[model samples]
Target chain A: MIITPIDSTAPPEPTPTPTRTPTPPASSASVRRSRLGRTLEPFGFIAPTALLMLVLMIVPIVLVIGYSFTDNVILNKNPEFVGIENFVTVLTDGVFATAIGNTLVFTVVSVIAHLLIGLAFAMLLNSPLVSNASRAVFRVIYILPWLFTAAVIAVLWRMLLSPNGVVNYLLSSDLEWLSSPALALGAVTFINIWAGYPFFMVSLLAGLQGIPADLYEAATVDGANGVQRFFNVTLPQLRPIIISMTLLDLIWTSQQFALIWLTTGGGPINVTEMLSTFTYKLAFSRYEFALASTSAVLILLFSMVLAFFYVRHQRARD
Target chain B: MSKEAHGRRRTLRVLGASAAAVALFATAGCSASSDSGSGDGGDVTLEFAQWWEPELPDGAFRELMDEFEAENPGIKVELLSGPYASTKEQLFAGAAAGTMSDVVGLDGAWVSDFANQGAIADLTALMAESDYDDSELASQIQVDGATYMIPVVNFVYPMFTNDDLLAQAGVAAPPADRSEFAAAANAVAGLGDNTSGWILPLSLEAPNGIQNDVMSWVWATGGSMLDGGQPDVTNDEVTSAVEYIKGLWDEGAIAPGAFTMKEQDKVEEFTNGRVGMMIDSLAHINLIRETNPDLKFSISALPAEDGFDGERGIPYASWGIGVAESSEHPAEAWKLVDFLMSEETNAKLSSIANAFPGNTESVPDFVAEDELFATAFEIYQNGYPANEFTGLPVAEQLMRLFDEQFQVLLDGGQSVDEMLQKTQEAWLAEF
Candidate 1:
């Protein structure tokens, strides 16, 4: 009933908290007030985050989940609860199916490419012989995309890829980079991976450094090659991080719409509509709030599964 | 030891506060946003939310705003221009979240949608009570037979011709008949390397332009898009009009990259003296003229061939101002609307802004010398809006269908027969 995400895989903690932590003892009159303060200090320190999370994150999510059960059109003064109807409608809806298909395809493509390329780059950055200045320069260039606003990145990439835009000017011909349906989805996914890989690369580098060098040294002494060393020792060490990153990336990429929306507006026959874009179009453009919330809650439900896996993975690592 | 530790903590706290204060001060004194809140009585600031481009947050309109503030004792306007594509997105979010401004600017097409949703006000009674004239308003203000919008400036379609090309081609004047127009394309086909002979955008992506053009053809053939206030796209005239446009697509008379061209690209093709003929919005008249005032481009109506009256007129578009029904100050908003429609205010706005006058009484004088205005007025006088086919919000998918399928048909990706059937199917599904 407590619904800990890691009900089975959490194994067991070695011990619970020890009860006898030391407290500063004070004298007579002031002692009572200070003792009370001592008892409440931890609560006071935790209060801000607790309040923020409750109001900002928890309340909105609860409202969304609640709205998913109701009919909440634009002009409706009060929403009517119709239990399970929105969910049933979503399951039967063709548009929802198309969006989920598109979203999953985009997520898998972007995540796999990101992990492979990010791992390679992370290893390169972690090389002991790489110069500090060169490393700094590469880090700056890599992190730049993450620093840029998604809107700016979308717009910049749009300009680069427009038919008669800068890219065509450089090539001295109308390359038809964006207009053609053949290259359109690939173009968008490439931009996504380029804009996304640096975060994974930096994190992977940190994870790589945490893997003891002595393990790799032992593998090398056993006459394992460089690629073999990576697969045997490095792969085993990074499994938890990789799983967590995959789950995180899946959620993030599935929810990504601004880049696609700004770049293509889900055109060339709604080719770019992922789950998030479909929900946004329904909620805002179509004013079908009940339907949009249904889509959102569906995403939430899937995210809950990912969240459970993530928590279990993290706890196991602990 | 405890006192010293407390002293050290106090010093750290002061340092943190100092750093925070410095950061806050750094951002302060940058620009006092006029729309943050209603200042004291001496300075009333109003926030305006719109998606107009030239009227971007800090462009030509910014200087005008500074001037408005300079003259009015305490009245300041903060302009919030959102992205053009996402205005509808912002408007609906405004409806749901209750974040709309006191004044709203939207396409006249949307007045009814917003009015029905209880998001916009009933300007009918407001106008009746005031000195507002209904004739000055745009033609599309009525939604479900209710008058509910304030007509701002309009951007009606008027055909533009390269007079120099027509003269050289021995066409005495721009064609006034559709048969003659088609013949004109044949004659002008190989005029020169620099000449494309004729140009109309294939995209219809900006459907208003295409709607205007198609309606001209429909009217030319004595047909309307609606009969008894319903869509009638299957009619003989509508069918012929579609085929006639398809014929032009077949003739290869349009610019090659017309499908991919944006608004500016279309204008540049015409303005660079490449296109022999072009059709565009009346609002873009200044833009065309500004490119090269010396260019002998002229404005005219779309030629007619099959009208019962032996001629037809362009279909029109209009822009308008509307107050949110949720506005806190409806009375004040109405006052602003009345002021905007007043002859004095109209003249002031028209002189400063490139906006056409909305007052019917004064528009004649305004357009007396300007031939472009004369042509647009002629179009507006005779123009009609095609049936919306679907409701405005729902019509997005329908319009997208028209745009997308037109591209498909133009590219020969589908036969005309298939295009017709598919278009009907798409519209029926959306409608």
Candidate 2:
């Protein structure tokens, strides 16, 4: 996992061979020793993450993929292979389509909203007008979103957003916002943004803080205005974190089920049915495990394609 | 630090970390066995599963379980109740996949569904050996010409009326028929300020007290939730039932949150003097009285049509106990079921649970001797059995459709004829 951090970035920094060459004039044995140390250094750093990735991630994916092809009844009898049938059924179903559409809208809007707002907060937090103590306070405030468990976050949001809840209590309207198809997607997105933006804000703040003060200083010294300094230096410095966070958000928000499940249960007319909740309802609620498994495989395929594009784009950026 | 050595160290680190993680996960799977106490027969464990997580407050079931343990001496029964919504899903999965417990609770109505799936064991022979009359078990056990589930207790749905509230409206009896019930609702509703005539659950949601309250009315009018021998819901009888409900709505007998209130809310409102009356499961006698012991209420058959042959009310489906197919000790499991369901034990259990124990002896004693359950038992006897499949896969959808149309019909904004046509069309097409 850590080795990938150094992979294919900046074309080897356009090496000037002689100037950057290892100085080995002290002795051939010393040169050999340095070479050997260099060889082990990457592994020394990456071994832990690589090991975690294999056990915690790879093994499960392999198991699920193997199960996907089988009619694993899961309780009574041994599972046997049915092969691609689950996938085919899921793709053909209209409900899965609705779920996918809802998930896409939720993921895209929530991720972008969190990213832009987080960046804005990051910039404001970086301001000179805000004192260090208050900035620390704001940092603490930002953790509120991250601290709420998903179920609690959903319930809190539901009460605040219900027709009879505080949202309408403040607004003074009996509008069934959750049951309204026009507003349901936005309502869920609002929850995801509220519950998830703190992560982005915190990560962006850290990334922005890591930017060299000298570069901003240099730009300002060169008579670059505030906007120019931000565009030229701050933006470039935060690009890597922003792209990664967006990808992470895509994966996380797209899979939101608990919030929607608790709040609406895919409501008034299946208006808020996202893939994750739909799959759960199918597998458990209706006991359509085969169809549920098929939907899962479809989600896996869609996300893999998304991840592939993200990685390729990331590679291109590097 | 050569290339080979570097690779070897990385692999070793990965392997070491993986080994630790695997060990940690493997350790988490261990569970403490419940059957750990001293046993005269050296500890026999019976894993019992039910949808109820906590035992009902009624103490009868526990007493029965203790008696079973005493009778058998060494066998211990462990209770398992899962989360409400998906426990059945889990049970279905467990049954289909063949790892179910020693005994399970099956809804008497869905005996056929489970039986068809081969997920439940046939208990025909077991019933024959028991003291229970085999013919009476017909409603629960003989679905699709076969015996599948065994009844543990039977709960009948009855019309629960607030006697004081009824007197305030100058009425003698709650309601004897469809016409009188609607008239009574209007009159009694006049007693309380801004009060509606009834507090039936309008929502299809859980604890949807108002809706089920209304269903008794619908069924009493000779409508079935399902068409004859088919799941297709759209039909004239259903439409007539919907129309009758619309008429009640027109009379302004419904509560404001009736369409949306949780089930318990209906019962609670009536008990708290918030509503004139509520209709619900007769098993609620204990729980209802718990809220307000002084509150005056009576159980009666829901108002029937002018001259219907059958009793007007519905007997909410029965419950059954069955041994699992996988049990190594089927005899012990059946013995336990039979004992718990025996006349004496069932009577004791029924008293504690505040429900109709399946045993005829137990039921007669409770209904005939006990004051509390007498009215409810009479209602159960005269009432038609609520079908096992009344609420099926699309139950919520059916309830919502009924509420929506019922509301429209009452508001006089839509004709009952039109409402029924559209609603039934949508209903029948669903299945």
Candidate 3:
């Protein structure tokens, strides 16, 4: 015999109400006031955050933009407005052009390397053959590089890559890794890649775990190989996370200054000079705050463009 | 409650919280201002910012400050100590904000820039107003004929040689001229096992490498990179010096990675017994000894050019003192400066720091106690202290510019003439 299931979690149907005395209608002024309050309530909740953003973010950005159009700025008492002359000078600089090229290479190579390395590690950890205990140990080992601060990483790599260091000892080669004009940029980029991949690995691992097992089972039932499963199922499932991580990594790697400053210092004749270092030298080393501000604004614009794409991608995925 | 009443209450709560936050921030700012102002009970507080305290023996500088406090009851001193780079950054920020410390430790390279920007006080005028005696001071860093900094202690860069390496190379003594120096360097380099003859730190990050290592060679022979106080980088003396160094580079006599090596790395290499010789500050002698006590080394004058007979020019750096133009306690700051420059105090400071006293009349006891100090003292007495980068506008930038070109020259990217000409033009633009 079929038994009808009871819906206990659902609310009971409303009972018939008895007749009651009618209340007087409210006045027009009170109705108008209530409507106005309902409209303004959300704004009240957001007022503090909006005020903080105005003071901390918008104010400094506006000040920096104003300074970019002036001459000599902080070093001079009464600086004169020079319109876009500072921008003109920074754009015309050969060192700045070199910095742009170097930054592009460093960022693109670092992002690509981070993605490949992270994905490979995440796949290994996610394999069904791997035991939980072994996965835990391997996960910790893979994430070790990201735990170190930039300064520590810089010093560690410097010691390892020195001409007489352990790396040279193992290779039996005396290469000037950080100092060679041709090798300096690549060396720094490699270091950044080492330090950065763990971030991607952790994020992608979560994304990989979130994929339903039924999809993989279905692919296997359809006669797909391991590589085919990855390409057709795993990659497509993780595309959103991968895109987000790539854009974020690109932004971070492009702004890297401390590691390069502590390592090569954009040296061997500016072969590793990034835009961050170039701007830093203009302001602090050379005391040309106006030009530094101009360079900074240009960087901001570039970053804003990247951010626009990032936001658009995130919206579309949502 | 009615909806309008609830909304009004919520709005009032937010306004009240924001007011509290503003009040908190205002109070914090007021407290910070008060903390940075003069002390209680009419006592004047002078902030003394410097990089020397860390470099000196631990707590030795604090003791000196205590002595000053004991002598001057009405004025109190606060020490704001840090590394040189951070100190420079902080002081520059302070200068721009017009909140500089009353007393400041300066480098000779910073004097011209600080003076030109009106950040530092004219010590010549301050001295005259205070009736302070200036005769005993060894030298003063001046800008446009106005003294801005007084050297409190001097550390000269002298050639430090590993006696063991030299003996192994069959050199009887430290080279006395450029040719002998070159021969000794090559002989040592031939010893192999990753050994090199010399370590030249030409890193543009701290381009003082050019001042202390490269240009010191030119100065060793009474040569000058300046003509009538203007840059003469293309002059014959500089040309000869650059060519000599380039010859060494071609011979592979200099250490590898010299292009990116820093001054500290040079010191480390020498201390680790990895190099035969280096032109380094006498201030590092104690550090080298501390790091490697078994290492045998000797100090001597940097070798002069061949066939030259004149007093050598020793490249010297100093722990300089100055007062901020924005200081409220300028008089008290002058007292601190004068106290530091006094013969007794300068002697005590120099002895503790393993440096020569800036007061020529004051003799540090290290001269008689430590043989290395004695040798350096002899070199100091026989040679004239000279550094062309001192008192030059944007001196550090000039060094970086020259260093970039020098690296190119060493890499065979350009001729020595082209490097010097390019450097001269860059320097002229800065000047």
Against the true structure, whose DockQ is highest? 3
- Tens-digit lDDT string for candidate 3 (B1-431): 57777777777766756765675575456447545647889999999999999988889999999999999999899999999989999999989988889999999988888998899999999999999889999999999899999989999999999999989999989998999999999999999998899999987677788999999999999989989888899999999999999999999999998877889989998898889999999989888998999999999999999888899999999989999999988888999999999989999999998888999999998999989999999999999888888889878888989999999888889999999999999989888
Candidate 1 similarity to native, TM-score = 0.75
Candidate 1, after superposition: displacement of residue B252 in Å?
5.7
Q: Give the alpha carbon lDDT tens digit for every residue of A1-318 in model 3.
A: 235586999898798688775544767677777678667656655655666676669988999999999999888999999999999999999999999999999999999999999999999999999999999999999999999999999889988987778899999999999989989999999999999999999999999999999999999999999999999999999999999999999888999999898888888899998999999988877788999999999999999988998999999988
| Per-residue lDDT of model 1, residues A1-318, tens digit only | 134476676678778677976556654557686577557555555554565576669987888888888886554657788999988988898767877887888888999998998898988988888888998888887778888878899768866876546777788776555445556577778889988998889889889989998998999999999899989998889887788898898778878888877665554454565788778766654456787888898898888888888888889889
Give the Cα lDDT of each candidate: 0.67, 0.67, 0.91
> Which 10-residue span in candidate 1 chain A carries the lowest summed lDDT?
A264-273
Count steric clashes of candidate 2: 18
Which model is ahead, 1 or 3, in terms of TM-score? 3
Q: What is the per-residue lDDT of model 2 for residues B259-302, given as tens digits with 9 covering 90 to 100?
A: 33456656667777656766777776777788899888887777
Which structure is stronger by lDDT: 1 or 3? Answer: 3
Interface RMSD of each: 10.1, 7.8, 8.1
Residue-level lDDT of model 2, residues A1-318, one tens digit each, is 223466665567765566666667769787787677667666655655665677678876776677677773443246678988877777787767888788888899899999988898888898879999999999888778889888898667755764445777688775656645457677777888888888899899999889989998899899999999989999999998898889878987888877777665664345577898778765653445555666777788888877987898789888
Q: Which stretches of candidate 2 lie over 4 Å from their true place?
A: A1-89, A120-142, A157-164, A180-183, A212-234, A310-318, B1-44, B57-63, B108-110, B129-139, B155-215, B244-310, B315-319, B363-378, B388-431
What is the TM-score of each predicted model, taking all chains together?
0.75, 0.73, 0.93
